[model samples]
Target chain A: MTHHAPTNIPTTGPDDLVVRGAHVLDPSSGLDGVMDVRISGGRIAEVSENLKGLRNIEADGLHLFPGFVDVHAHWRTPGREDEETIETGSAAAAAGGFTSVVMMPNTDPVIDRPVVVSGLVRRVEGESRVRAYVSAALHEGLKGERLTEMRLMKEAGAFCVSDDGLGTQSSGVLRNAMLYAKDSGMPVILHCEDHTLATGVVHDGAAAALAGLPGSPGSAEDVATATALVLAAETGAKVHVTHVSTALSAALVGFFKGSVPAADVTADTTPHHLTLIDELVQSLEGMYRVNPPLRPEGDRLGVGEALRDGILDFVATDHAPHASEEKYLPLEEAAPGFLGHETAFSALFTELVLGGSLTLSRLVGAMSSAPGRWVGDGAGRIEAGAPADLALVDLSEEWTVRADGLLSLSGNSPYLGRNLKGRVVGTMVGGELVQDRTGARFGSRA
Target chain B: MPARNLLTLEGTSRADLREVLDLARDYASGTVDRPLAGKIVCLAFFEASTRTAVSFELAARRAGADVISLSERGSSIQKGEGLIDTIVTLDSLGADAIVLRHPAAGAARLAALHTEAAVINAGDGRGQHPTQALLDLHALSGHLGGFDELEGRKVAVVGDVVHSRVARSIIPAFRAAGMELAIVAPQTLLPLDAGAWGLPVLPSVDDAVDWGADVLYALRLQKERMTGGSPRVPSVPEYARFYGVARRHLAGGAVVMHPGPVNRGVEVAGDVVLDASSLIPDQVASGVAVRSAVLALSMDVARSRVAA
Candidate 1:
């Protein structure tokens, strides 16, 4: 019943391992050629053609890229662990070839104070298999009210600030937040929604009209994007608009990319928004109900183009997990979001890159180097001095996505029954093998 | 085709609809009896309902099925029991059929996924009420001579089209019978993408009357659609002046219909509700026979499955 093919690494294995004969695709180094990589002391020891070591891992006919980094993800820790705990979420990320993920701050008490941020960081260190970073809420309770202690949160190891599940509706509060985030050297992740125009359960178009449900217009996102761009421009903050859904939002993000400094204004799109469209809501199923709900085909194509043209900076999973009971409720009552961390790369590689809409380098850039730059971690590169965070994928492997096969507590992925190309067969974080799909070596008890 | 669960009227074939209406006629004329005698029917009303609740209880008993009534106020649901838990409990108690009404859209469909009992949707908030649409069809057939005569005829659905599950169900049900629909409502009450429906849109009731609408299906105007309401249409008197079906509009020989509990002076005049041309009473009467036919059809399917 497991999607992984029963490969394992020893529990107390040494970091002196070598990967042989694999096509290494590193966006940071522009090295899209076959090479052997040697991992020692939790870093890349060598990247030559004939690297030799005591324990050699054979990897012929595979593409090795940097492990994925997601900047906008909802792991729902500290509360709502029944949906996804920190360890389970990190395990899912490791299985999906993600080495580092920034968790959203919309949990039970909401990750607002420095105490909460520090506590989560310690918990992640003790329990998580992958590097899990926390993002603090910009407001005290994510109420869009008073600001939290941004500098204190940054000191406590929070890399970003966001009121992700809730929108920062007040421009005064948002402007002040950007100003403070710029001072603290932390990026501000905007959810980008105008509540006044966001009353609809579905996209404010043919889907909503046909179902007789309330409609949320594309203009809602456009209005919010324009507001955030103006604020980013005003405060000179590193503003990253997360889950950009509308074409107009993508256009606004594109228009602001070069107008401001490269890092000052950036945006990202999710895997679901780039592939699915508003028409999916016709099913009246809860799986299709996402915030900034899936827009029209034009918007889907627009974000795809944005990623290709570098208008959008990277891809984040927004991997919100909910109990099946919560997600399987009526469409109106069901919570929004899909299981993303486990299926993001496979779906995008099959539908966008291999389908001819995007290049493999561009896909890797969005999934790896770009998000790594957003997090400013030494995680998205393959160099002699860089961390040994890597993913070995079989581009020719074709597999169908199944809910039960995932490692997450909830299985609400939009690509649940899809046949996708490009399966990640192995993953390593900090010179430690976390996932091995070969089912033959080292911890192969199964 | 007759689906195992009657969640919505969409995609139902003309023959299946005719079968329901014909069976209803038999029940109304006292020809069919005790078809569901040994069956156990559970009436689970998670929302407040009058006609649908009472009629379904009477229908189940008249067909000789033992009935159990559960409402949100008195049942465990009031103590915060979930809908799925309640449905599973009823299924464990050997319920052969479950008639459900809830305030949330798609409740019946969700229940159908949880249990094997023949699920019937009495009403599911602004989503669908298949039985209501069937009863309305039965009453309309009686008024227009027969169901066959419904072909090429025009029926105008007026007021609050967006919030009306009745409209959602009736539109497809009537379309299946070869009947054309003229949906009349203010732009506020109409769905924002009504053009996609491919039905004729009449902005006012007078326009539908002039278009020779054979039946006026008036929906209730929930005081909110008035001037100060959420969607913010014109005032109550202004709505009555334009979209409401008054006594004067009834002079055009078009039959008036209301899914009862009507807004007397808002959507339809009080006198027009009980006028000689009103099918409101007959629509109420048709609810019982139509529900009985539905129960019988579902029980037949369940019995056949068990035998197989």
Candidate 2:
């Protein structure tokens, strides 16, 4: 986990965007050897080294892999576009080696029905170079009482349904949807903050009491996650926990590890929750402000252990964006999410990879394979038939997180000026070059 | 020869200062209970005051009243509203009483002429913080077993008195009670008219304590007013060497007092403030009692007029 100064290797040329593999490591397909991945039509057209002079990029001291998939995020869309938008958010996704993302449906026009669902899909398709999937809310505007037209929303192409920012207050409606979702083969993603119990932001503990700051109590996350697990167990439906920030959520994941049938539960934890502690908040100024506020030092280190042990599933960018002016608004009034896409790989490498709490195998698996499997994605593996959506990275490179050096449009990032030990050198979305490390330019490889 | 000390006050009387402390005494006992049910203590601090602001606000509320701490900052004052206009605005708000802290001496008295509501001086430009002086007296009387009487005691006033409103009001109380007084400070920090009161003004803390004064009242080190004065007191270490009170300064069973939010190791040693004779914390506690008394007495007088 030692990082010397990185070699100033030149970035990829326009003609040869990806290198022929020197050593390719794809944990999803259990493939680890020299392999070549090719580009055409913005989708994986071929995966052979001898597939005719197809832009032979140099692969010396580099690792090529699939672009990541993030299934849960509050883009702060429609309503609070100052925090994040479809174009800026997709650029964030692509910068972190994410080719596609499942956008949370808690915006101005809460995606509860097919019309709102189709609107977001069209917005992303129209404005973004990346594919964006919308998760329709469980109830109308996520009020948690009346259910929206679930079958109609699925027909309109929502991958799942979730009350992302808050838990469904009505258990009966949530149960009904889970059963219906089980029948339709669609999962229900839940945010897991029981409204009646959640009083404020930040983890409520002795530390919060001393500081006179309000606490986002653990019982709220515990009760919501437990409730969701029981509904998932009873209905035998697939459920995914979004932004799992508490220790009890990790504990509940362990508690329900093998207890139910037809219960395919996966969770994604964010980068901010992993590295930053409450003490760090005292120093990081205010950029560390986020939902389920930052955890205490114990919870911060506990998440690292959870990632290493594989109790937690993937380390998601949850890659939320916010404006500088909006973020500077005092603690109570500031936006809830922070930018993570540009800093995701570098931060993950610095913490899990360089810090020695997580392995390269699990990092790739969680970031790529696990998200792909939960959403029925074709990438996360570099096998013969898998799509050529890829992320070529320099494992030996040590770089500091610079705001001016990101491909994402938004300048708000929590890891601004943080020194990290790894970075994404190249990114291919469906065989098309979406991001290149040289000149840090973004274009299609097709 | 130690110089004789004199204190200049706007109202000029030893008897009047005793009346203030006597009223402060009744309030300190919590015996004078009146909610001032419909009364308002308008705290008009034109500048910053943390302790004074909070103490006055709490005093009004604890007696079953309400308080509206009008912040002078970011108000119409910034819009060129003069002091007279601000006073009129406060009067219109139906303030039962106004506590005024201004940068000019006599501003509180001027403010009183402008409004029918009673104006309590919360300290006007270092002119006279008479309430703080009365509370200091009340604290000394209670701690030293001299309640309702100060006929023959000795007090040593040390530290800055040249520009302190607190010193201006406190000296008369000791003088009117037929007690001995000692003004001890450096030449620059000493009042210019020290020889007029016919008492001793020793030049150092050790010299004052050696005269067996029954109480030592330490003035806050007034750095804010120490401009254009040469031969100023030395550095903190040198100040402590020449004037800062220590355990050695308690030459007898004398009590120690300070008007606080004290600067540690500057005007007084940290441990000295925590010593056996220090009534500093008790002085802060007495502030609430003194204010409640002021509010009640002022309200009663106002009420009698309405009844008449």
Candidate 3:
């Protein structure tokens, strides 16, 4: 399999610097202590108690971890630049301590052909602040009818293929696409939903009944997930299910994992799914509207347990952004999504880690190493010979999320007005400072 | 009562219901007072409505308030004006109350966010029609003698309860008014886990009559429910056979009610609609008075008058 490295253009080459005296934690490498990490040629050269370099950053009392990798996000470039551009989206990811994000290809003129894939890669290289990988659409225009050229798309720099905004209705169509993706060595990211059952805007529950809104049953997600898993077992294709909101879907993934050991299936649940429930939809606010809609408390707890038990593999911020006009309407007419890139870690930290449902190390693994391994980059580790993708966080600091304070162009986050305990102070991609909130500079380069 | 907007009737108190019903009774008795003389009421209907819109307009005019009407067709709303923009415009025009009928659920709540005006939800998609519930209660209470006499009275909400905004509002409001409620609909036409509402699910209209129901509140059988791409009911005849309240069902001294623009023979027998026991006409007549009470209460005009 040919590895397509995530594309990004750093302003300066090969920083010779040291991140000093920070509580370095890399769960994958089993290093959890205060250490100085040295970087040379944009790669971590050493991690020790005391390391000195020409340029040093004093990161005392802060926590440093490998940068997060978001396997699912919508940058909304090329089509809805008004909602989010690649530059702003990457900056938001950097602020959220995400070093690498795979962009979903449901843009205006959907990214199905090799030309579109190559064009997006070039745009990411030129405009993005952090590494951004392109995932070409599995179906042309995401219509789920005709398969795109997956092998050619991978050759043109696509790391995966997805038709994220919509689900493939036909099992035959999805199976054919999976076969093509398997041959092309591209992982298939499935957003599973039976469209007929998902006709309602919110999760079908007591909240929907009370609010009198139309509801989509969890069977919608479960049925589609079962189909995808069965086909994955049959086709021997690598399938990564994004935004597994319902408990049954996660259980389906777990069931398939044991039944078909060689199926090669992984699943992710979003931070919103981990913490929020369908009760929020009772307010009828559009910001709470999302695809695979926020489920009941039982489903929320079940999905969280799945992630904690490793039945669900990682955390991916399906960071979909929409303009205010699109989001601030009535629930039925509003666009379905939340601005996820900026709040992924803080939300998880406040809700999961601090709440004792998940340990910080496990959270780090899910956000960083697990997804990074899936991305096939060998990136998300603070070790020698690995890319210096890192985040400096002030874990003790308490900050409230505000729309005006978010780096993303759209202020559609459900976390708006939430007080979180941890905040990303600084972020580095390949030893270059992509985000700096330290308010102090240690030294200048020679 | 602390909330300015009457978005839903789910959490409404008996005292609040009494206040509205009493005022509506007085208005029906030809009470003369202009509590809303200085107020401006804006009627914004993004969906088509005949009874709700006309009655709200008549209610506001009868209370001597200045009225402004906006409909989806032949208006700036038709030109792609958002609900928020229209709400802001109404608020900016010094509207003291905005009666809204929108085609999306939660529209009244969303509109309440953008404006200071008290939003009265006439009907919002498949969501609540709070005022309709209020007027229904008023009509029923009048027929039953008084609100105090409504206690332990059994009413069966029959047919298409899932898609009916009327059912959504009436279920809670009627329950809060001390009426014991049961639902009579096909399994396909019921909400998810309908039994979770703590109400009995009677199988047929005959069973509802056998269960000693005092009232048979039938909801309109929407045309789409029977003829749409995926039919909820097999046919109109099949729906009427089991769920419709026929004239024979009224032998047990049960009255029939429907929120209208009703299909005459679908949810209720055509002859049964004009039966002496049918309160359908009274439900419509109660609209203007009950809406007047609601508008006055929402604007705090009635509250101020009581305080004075």
TM-score (chain B only), all candidates: 0.95, 0.86, 0.97
Report how far off residue A175 is in candidate 1 (Å).
Answer: 1.8
Model 2 score (lDDT): 0.68
Is model 3 an incorrect, acceptable, medium or high docking prediction?
A: medium
Rank by TM-score (best first):
3, 1, 2
Considering only the true interface residues, what is the Cα RMSD of candidate 3 after superposition? 1.5
Task: Supply the DockQ value of model 2.
Answer: 0.02
Writing each residue's lDDT as its tens digit, candidate 3 over B185-230 gives: 9977876757657789989999999999999999988788776545
Better of 2 and 3 by TM-score: 3
DockQ of each: 0.43, 0.02, 0.62
Model 2 lDDT per residue over B121-157, tens place: 7876545676787677777777866644565788888
Compare the candidates by TM-score and give the number of the best one: 3
Docking class of 2: incorrect
DockQ score for candidate 3: 0.62
Regions of model 3 farther than 4 Å from truth? A1-3, A7-15, A441-446, B1-4, B33-35, B303-308
| lDDT of candidate 3 over A1-446, digit per residue (tens) | 45457546452446668888899989999999998999988888899977888788888899999999999999999899999999999999999999999999999889999998888888988898888889999999999999999888988999999979898999999999999999998999999999978878999888887777788889999999999999999999999999999889999999999888879999999999998999998888888899989999889999999999999999999999999989888888999999888888999999999999999999999999899889866768888988888999989989999999999999999988889999999888988888886655433322
Off by over 4 Å in 2: A1-18, A40-52, A283-285, A407-409, A439-446, B1-308
Clashes of each: 2, 9, 0
The segments of candidate 1 whose C-alpha lies over 4 angstroms from its true place after superposition are A1-16, A211-214, A258-263, A439-446, B1-3, B225-230, B301-308
> Which pairs clash in the backbone of model 1?
A6-A439, A7-A439
Model 3, global lDDT = 0.89
